[model samples]
Target: MEPLALLWDGILAATDPAIFACTILGAVIGLLIGALPGLGPTAGVAIMLPVAAGFGGVAAIACLGGVYYGSMFGGAITSILLGIPGDAPSVMTVIDGYPMAQKGEAGRALGTSVFASFVGGFLGIAGLVALSVPVSRYALAFGPTEMTAMMCFALSLLSVLGGRNAFKGFTALALGLWLGMVGLDPISGLPRYTGGSMNLFDGLDFSIIAVGLFGLTAIFTSLEVNVDKPVAKYTFASLLPRVSDAVQTRWQLLQGSVVGFFVGVLPGVGASAATMISYALAKRLSPTPEKYGTGIVEGVAAPEAANNSASYGSMIPLFTLGIPGSATTAVMMGGLIMVGLQPGPLLFTENPEFVWSVFGSFAIGNLALVFLTLLLTPLLAAALFVPTAYLYPIVIAVIVYGVFAIDASTFNVTLTILAGGAGIILARLDYPAVPLILGLVLGPLLERNIRRTLIQSQGDLLVFVERPIALGLFIATVFVLLIPLFLKLTGRKKIAADEAEV
Candidate 1:
């Protein structure tokens, strides 16, 4: 069957009233969860996974995918109104969005966000529909050596692109790798890092770690900063921007969507990185660059669009390779596995309806998110008035519930608290949690592939470099690592020369 026909059939199936209703319910739940501080898409999905598991594959995926996109849209709500980012990707939105709120243009800022989100999200889904089959076929040819090289390349690129400090990113990555080494050895049956603890046999739960790192840590950080201050409120009659506003932002939205989609396709380069890079690039190329952080409509549009596009883009790798591109994608991946559907090349061909249903549902969910956001912004804004003391505790309760709900294990809850504490300390020391999460997600894959390659090659290490695809990936990894160092050296020399001249 042709891919186009398969996609059309999937869309028709997804648009069936039963599936559409499930998608709407999932989006509504996700939106509310994402609009609240400390509750990101990852946590939202984790909390809902068990419920999704009870349903069939199509319904399960529709609900999970809807939650994913809905959170992408709803995250901007708190970022704009409360200056508290609802998700890591929404952090950039707070820069321009909060400023607009402060200037009494909250409604317009939100309007721009919704429109940009729709554009980016719709484009991203289109890209996914157009690209997933090709990408999956390409991925199918990759053996253990090629897969290992690809993982190395992804980790290298992510470490370089992470933030100002490469060392910190590596530190986080290494910590995650070490944590991943726990439990039984992949090749040998011996346990290396379990330290004789029976509870460690299953390894640390990724969902627990995620809840602790993003959810609990965020709560602690909020409390430590200033939970006493009341959030300011602003009112506007409409949340819809003028047609001219959309026209003015067309270029920024386009560039951001494209950039976001590509980044999202890469494992470890998720929505946060895409949104931040897009916003920075948009500002750099804007005619009025100086007005960026001052609440310009384009400012909100660029990041919102980039983030939403990236959210959909990340799903490509997840569905194609079983490699999640971000924390939220990791949750989705886990949800799929829990529901007895393994994600990868076989998934696309064997479960074409499920794949297409997820893709089509993203398109529908984004539209629902737009309407829901328009209707709920006024109510969401009122949530800002809820005291942080009250809000924080509720958030904490939710995080606890979310953690336990995943596996219903007390050990998981304990692990979550420990991971949360570790996350808080890591954040204070400028270490990123994303790399750690990425490492945890990719660690098992990396180990399994390495052992498989060694076994296939009869312990010959040369097999990794012998293949063209693996060799190319290795070269790319080297370049990704070296370019940053070269750029830093050049920048330092220029700075030194300018200082000497002055």
Candidate 2:
């Protein structure tokens, strides 16, 4: 069937009143979950999986889709307003977003985020609708060798380029990798570093680490640092991005959307990797790269677009090939199964209406999410007005609640607290935490794939070079790692030559 005709069918199917209600309610819940710490889009969707199941397949999918994209917008709330990320995807948003907030442009940051996210979301859905089959088939070409190299390339993009201190960034990445390895070995089924505790059999929950690293760390920092800048009232003009702002960020939005959607199509990568990679890509492409962290609208636009696009891109594989591109989509796959809607090529042939309804829902969900985010901007911005002395306790409480909600485990909460202290120390030392987050997020994929590749090749290093795609990805990873160093060295030499001439 033609893509547009299929999409139109979906639009017709989604006009049912129940689906609309599900989308709206799910968006509301998703926004709330996303604006809170610890419970990211994945956890939010996971927690609501059973409840959404009761709504039936179409309604459940619409609801889950709403939440997925809604949380993408909501993540920017705390990231921009509070210097804390609501979820992992929004971590990049905090780099420039909170600074914009501090500069009394919280509204603009929020607006830019929503707008960019909408653009990304729309593009992602469009791609999914048009190219789902081709993309899924193309992805099938990636074997274990290709996956390992691709994962390495993805991890290298951020860990090498995003931080000022390469050594520190690597250290943080190492720490995250260690954290990812602390539980039982996935292949061996033996405890690696559980320390005789049953709580760690399932590994450290990423949500706990996420909440502790950003939410609790922010609270701890606020408690210790006494900055005297009084909160300023922001007018509507200062809150919204100007037309010029959009014009400036248009390229960034496009770049981020493309990068994110493509990367998100790969299984297990998620929005975290998409956002980090897009941010680095944006910086590399930017004329004013140094201004990224200090606050720039482009910086805010890029990752927001990337992560949203990635979310939509993730659904493509889930629908077409019964593969999940991320943890969030993995949960969504379960929902599909619960509703008796098995994913695969047969789904399009057997349940065309269901397929189209999902695509249509993504379109509607993105539009609705934009409005919800804009409407809630004022209220989210109001959070910035509260004094940190009074506000941080609430944040801490929320962090604890959010962490505890995952698995209902105390060990996870304890890990959160410990991670907070470690985050504070890392921040004080200027070691980047974002790279660590990426490492943790990508670790399983990296490890599992490499192990699988090794097993397939019987420990032959030549396997990496034998395949064309794997070799390309390996070369790309090396290039990504070396380019930054090359640039730094050449830059230093240029400066030295100029000084000597003077």
Compose the digit string of candidate 2's lDDT tens values, residues 349-440. Answer: 68878878978877887888877777776665464455766865654665566556545778877987898889889989999776676577
lDDT of 1 by residue, 218-272 (tens): 6676554432334546455558766888999999999989999988887666788
Clashes of 2: 3
RMSD of 1: 3.0
Q: Give candidate 2's TM-score.
A: 0.65
Model 2: CA > 4 A from native: 1-120, 128-132, 218-361, 386-399
Candidate 2: worst-modelled 10 consecutive residues by lDDT = 224-233
Query: What is each predicted model's overall lDDT from 0 to 1?
Result: 0.81, 0.77
Worst 10 residues of 1 by lDDT: 223-232
